[model samples]
Target: MSLKVAVIGCGSIATHRHLPEYAANENVEITAVCDIVGERAEEAAAKYQAKAYTDYKTLLKEESIDAVSVCLPNYLHAPVSIDALNTGAHVLCEKPMATSIEEADKMIEAAERNGKKLMIGHNQRFVASHQKAKELIESGAIGKVYSFRTAFGHGGPEGWSADGKESWFFKKDEAFIGAMGDLGVHKADLARYLLQDEFVEVGAFVETSAKENTDVDDNATLILKSAKGTIGTLAASWAYTAKEDNSTIIYGEKATLRLEDDPTYSLVAQYANGETVKYELGAIQSNDEGGQTTTHVINHFIEAIQNNTVPLIDGIEGKKSLAIILGALESVKTKRIYSLEK
Candidate 1:
């Protein structure tokens, strides 16, 4: 029984990650591709052998879709996702759940109202190296994790967005917050997932240092303190023109773990007792380097629907992570530590 899936907003994310992954998944049949840009939608449809739609509402009304991937701009995420949910389809929305907590709440409500699964596309959780690192941390191999520094940086979305420099990602109105929303949120989610704890306080400095003619910030540094007393820095930058830096360092009582930092190894463990071990999980997926082994996000989403189970990164989990980034933005605005409780 193949699940019929439709992709809304046939942008770079859909083209690069979702559509390809779904094409590979035998459990899903891509029934439709929709985008405001007719050509983009038609192009994807022609390649995937699915129907092309310029209006998502029309697609939702006509297509017999079991699930949909909402890859629209930051502002439209909530509205479009809610519409898809109301149309009786599970939604796998792209990151930074919504511009506001209120919007995220509505999205969750819509899914519950429709009895459909709503999974956020926080693909970092499904990365192979990240999965292995999580396993090691949970196994107590790191021994009482005390601190960490996780970062996601690249040349910027201009180099990757389907529309390039003219994309909505550069518009403050469409994007809301810049690199923090685009890249930092992923690290914020990853930190919460890896630490197995919620971030309680956030202090951040966000600014636009690179990419001219854009109001959005390109570089950001966030100081995060977990509920369990662990503190770390989460950085997001679009100024890494030299190369991408998607690395995390977790320091515990027994050892310090480095992820995606070294050219030779993906995971490196340096122990206090003078022992070094490297785990060869493989490279973290980068936009420039397109050989991503598999995200497994689509696979997990399909399985959850098939098994009547919850997706790993559900709406609530998505909201919690989104809250951290929101807090960071608040921190930048007010020049104060934004506490999650407030």
Candidate 2:
């Protein structure tokens, strides 16, 4: 049976990835789409051959929606996901599940109480290069992975959205944060996914240095300690002038894995026995692949639902990543090490 799917938020990601991918999948049907902007929802629904709604609650009440993709702003993620879970629909929420830990917990609680799957859109795990890195790490090529560094940043979203200033991404109340929420959480999430651990502590600093007159932070740097004793540095900024950059470097006892660097590869294994090899398998850049992050994301969720198992990026996983980012924000304010594990 085809899983009936409703997509909430018919913005860039929906138009480019979610609806299109669902439309291509024979196992799922995108039955509806919702957005606060009625025209945007209508346009998306028309293209995908689905119904349209301005209110997510209205879409939730519609019959036979087995699952939904909550692509709303960061602040609305928990409420919409919780409501969808309560409505007996599995939810695939976009990253940084919620602005606060408490909201994230409530979303998890709702999913548990309803016995529904709640997947987060930390899609980089499915990226080819990242998968390759995970394989190499698990195979011990990267040794113990004692430490790592990862970063993702861009020159802001002026080009993506038709109206840069009017985009909800700049609004603190709507988006919850700026570049950190927009890009940094993905790096943090990808780090956790690759390392197979949770960040326990974060000493961070964040400020709105680049985008003038914006309420949210446009630049952020974090020092994090993972549960596996891996201390890492991460930075996210919206001030980049040239191009988007997403890179990760791992320090293993034997070899080091570098992703998103030039030559587009992972798993450059170095051995103590005087052997150096480069695994030049390329990566799936998030902004590239036709701007298709949720394409791979929704496919994984469908596979999980079909197989009766867990998605690659689940809600609890989402909470873990978001906690690190939030901890960074807290650390910035307190100028102290924020403990997340406790």
lDDT of each: 0.92, 0.83
Per residue, candidate 2 scores C-alpha lDDT tens digits across 218-294 of 88889989888999899888887677778788888887777766554454655667787776765554553566444
Model 2 / residue 37 / CA error / Å: 1.2
Worst-scoring 10-residue span by lDDT in model 1: 284-293
List where candidate 1 sits over 4 angstroms from the true fold: none
Q: Give the CA lDDT, 0 to 100, for residue 247 in model 2.
A: 79
List where candidate 2 sits over 4 angstroms from the true fold: 270-274, 292-295
Backbone N/Cα/C clashes per model: 0, 0
Pairing residues by index, what is the TM-score of model 1? 0.98
Winner by TM-score = 1
> What is candidate 1's lDDT per residue for 1-342, written digit by digit as tens?
999999999888999889999999999999999999999999999999999999999999998899999999999999999999999999999999999999999999999999999999898998777888898899998899999999899899888999999999999999988898999999999988888998899999988988899998899999999889999999999998889899999999999989888998898989999999988876677786774667788899999999999999999999999999989889989999999975
TM-score of 2: 0.94
Extract clashing residue pairs from model 1: none
How much is 113 displaced in model 1, in angstroms?
1.3
